[model samples]
Target: MFFSKLSYTLGLCCLAAGTILQNGQVRTTNYPDIKIDVASYRFRTYDANATEISYKGRWDSKKVSWWSAPGLVFGFTGDTVAITFGDLTTDTTLVGYRIGGMDWSFTNVSAGATHLFVSSATPGVHETWPFNPLPFELRVTNWAYGVQIAQVHVAEGESLVRIPPHQRTIEFIGDSLSAGMYTSFEGLSSFAYGVGAGLGDTEYYVTAYPGICVSDQNCWGNPRGQAHQWFYTSDTSWRASTIWGDAPEPWDFERQETTPDIVVINLGTNDNNSANNVSTATYVDAYTKLIQGIHGKYPKAQVIVMQLWMGFYASGNSYAQNQGYEQELKDIVAYFNSDEYLSAPLVWDGATNTTTKLDAPSEPFVSYFSTRGIMQHNDIGPAWHPTDVGAIKVASHLSQFIKLTFGWELVATGPEIFHETLYWNDEQNY
Candidate 1:
């Protein structure tokens, strides 16, 4: 099993440069002038503990489970780079990858097969400069199952290309939309990806689950406890205490040694569904408490209560019935940003002059912004989620909001709200 101790002959793989070939899609922007070279045929292995690899998100040793958990970041000069994962929970799941932080392309995690996270075989990668190792990230694209990364295989005699540090860490909390629902593409075309890529130096962390809510009751099929996103770590986190009769500790945000600088909450749409509906006061109260909890954990973090109104869901029954409640949610955000919260310390110890994460919390800046687009009936993908056009609009707006709010660098403008392509790529989705 010690692959680093063994040696083997290598082969020549198909070579490529980063320049766009047939389609107009960009590959590697850094390497414009391109040429092809024969890549190493064989592989050298690195264990999970390798120093060349940098990790983000909540990891337990070599394993990580959570919605779109930021897995591994590294660089390598290999035509065929693959990863081997040992099943942590016996169920097969998906893992993803991208080079230079483009959209993630994914591969299935079979029991023992070597999954090529990135390779020359891929379309865009087929044209990237192969002389030096290109930066790559490995990610968990789902919460259905956890994964234990056992080994990373790259071209012969190659170690990982070291990943650079990010300017700040941002955590996104929400359900379906933020969870990057993957009926076909496993979180490849998520708005979160566009945000991170647009933000330039952001360390992305997401804790989204499908059907999670802001109230105590389950949203039809959800299993997390009351105010689950704040009170617990995951959907089944309450199982130990309620079902197995064990006093399990909730998720420890301090365990990570730091909290996110910015936290975006994209919930509230699921508050009122066919099965359960909470009162406006109940939803607002729960949401306020969730904000307090986040402040307690990360006081200086700028919180964005994103009310995504784009796509078909906005004009549907939920919007008609829950518009008032959504307004209430928006009002709570205004209250946080007002002078009232500054006077009320019990609600949030925000006005304190503190620089570090300590008992005396720092004042957090909060804002609410809704998407600026009419519901394109045609652009909505399966399950009423936004297609790439809609998501890009959200990403463009949200990224600019974050950039301006934090006084960070400027972000490039992406597609407009009314983008050209309203057609859903049905062939790629289920």
Candidate 2:
């Protein structure tokens, strides 16, 4: 039930004003507790690939998941912050933390919690006052854990600050509702991280998985060496391989440092699940070779092909009504737009057989993103996935369809990225 989430970081935070007891931890009545003069505090560890820790997604810096580094922003001048981590599969992990980024606080190290704290000053109060440094920014929520970070204490005269890196980036590849799973808190309420925190200076990367399959074989949830969780990098059967290293490989992406100006791709509902009946020419040749391997590793990415509100081999499937597979994802984005970057004209309305449209200069970008009923079933949950208010209304309509297909503007801070036009038609929804 760890749903504690609150964000207001449009640019690092430290407005200090903590106080959240009742077992909610986070109480720095304007800073003081460094054990209130435990010799002016001293801890300072910081090795989890420490470049002053800022690691973002597709995580494999030796195992860190939320389908890949879901979150781990760090910086401190202390009042409190400690997180050592090692083990916790407590019914599929759950540990969220925050401060300065307001509210959020959760933990389920399941009795063996290796260590975690984000108290701005009142965890076990004994207040003797005086010790204010405050510059906090603590964050460590990598839900659906694969925990392995091994240090980050912060107290010893504090100093770690390095939170800089966000100039647009989004790279979610999906399954399990774009890996935000039954959202009460999975992949940090996925929608690939709330469309990378509502596109505010972006920064996202996921590579989802659950019952993944874009057709690498007759699927059934990791059925048989399924290499369709978007050509792997993780998911050695949900991380194993003798300590994350005996299998699963093929995802180098030329050692990323940002190369995803948009990738989306929610993939075919487990190859049209009916026990993976996969065959419409093998799910259109493995979803057209997974968009020719994301156009040979992101050649100006902007892929996007979502359409699949929910489906896990029939335990309450959602839609594919008239399964023509949304016209085979508009013929695989018109064979990856083979006609000089498909300069608009993909209108096909066929009487609401579940919409399709790519009308724009749309160059180099293969499109289509219709999760059909666009969420409604109380915004889903439990197996039918999507629930964190349905991954925040599917990340606020895919962040207003990538801020109207790349004219981009909204830099987080709620609502108003305009350009709306996803009006469905099976009796309602817009």
- Model 2, which residues run further than 4 Å from truth? 1-65, 78-80, 84-162, 168-204, 215-218, 222-259, 262-275, 285-300, 304-334, 345-359, 366-430
Worst 10 residues of 2 by lDDT: 3-12
Best by lDDT: 1
lDDT per residue as tens, model 2, 1-430: 1111122121012111112221233433332212222234467777777776766665565645436336667556656676656553322244555443244445444322334365555442223233123223322233234655666677667677766667778887766566654443455566776777667767777766655676666344354322354555565343444445545554566775567888887766666666566677877766766665565456567788877654223335553322347887887777777765355324321112122334444455687877665666655543455556667777888778778877777766632221112245796655
Q: What is the C-alpha lDDT profile of model 1 across 1-430, one tens digit per residue?
A: 0001011010000011212211223433232111112232367888877777776665554344445455777877656567766655223454556665345454445554456555666544545553245777766655444566677778787567776667687887776666555322324346775676567656777666556676656664554423544444434432223422333335666665246888888776667553455666777876776777677677678888876442343454444211325578678888777765644533322122122323443464788866645335554554456666656666777887777777777443442222122465658656
Q: Which parts of model 1 are misplaced by more than 4 Å? A: 1-44, 77-80, 89-92, 101-104, 116-133, 143-146, 182-186, 230-252, 255-258, 308-324, 344-364, 372-375, 410-430
Model 2: pairs clashing at backbone N, Cα or C within 3 Å? 200-411, 200-412
Error of 2 at 2 (Å): 33
TM-score of each: 0.70, 0.33
Candidates' C-alpha lDDT: 0.56, 0.54
